[model samples]
Target: MLNNIGLPGLLLIAVVVLVLFGRGKISSLMGEVGKGITAFKKGVSDGSKDDEDEDKTLADGTAARDVTPEAETDQKKV
Candidate 1:
């Protein structure tokens, strides 16, 4: 449905938005959007670094927690 927005149509929309919200308001909104994008990128990179860091403990430099379950006989009656 959005395939029909030509240059003039886009311009008209831009003009309408500019009229509804003045230059200062739009500028501040854009600035906030820029900051949000930057923060999102930073968060994604940090998350990847955290995933890489998870391999920080084995003999081969990778971590693996023990998950072996003990036999029922290993538990004595309380």
Candidate 2:
């Protein structure tokens, strides 16, 4: 379906974008977009590591401690 647009249509769209934004602004915008994508990927990777750490902590089985109702009330008082 997209093959119908061809080179001419793509060039027209590029020209329109260039006219609207100018070359420097478009280049800066693309650079910012690339940086944003990189940051997002890094964040996802870091978050996945955090998740794995949590999973590993949970797997150790000693992390889950039962809190008594009295302990909860005492902590809340603080």
For candidate 2, the per-residue lDDT at 37 reads 100
lDDT of 1 by residue, 1-78 (tens): 999999999999999999999999999999999999999999999999887677666667767776555664456433
All candidates: TM-score: 0.69, 0.68
Model 2: per-residue Cα lDDT over 1-78, one tens digit each? 887998899999999999998999999999999999999999999999998778656665657555579878898899
Best by TM-score: 1
Pairs clashing in candidate 1? none
The per-residue C-alpha lDDT of model 2 at residue 73 equals 83
Clashes of 1: 0
Alpha-carbon RMSD to native, per candidate: 7.7, 9.1
lDDT of 2: 0.89
What lDDT does model 1 reach?
0.87
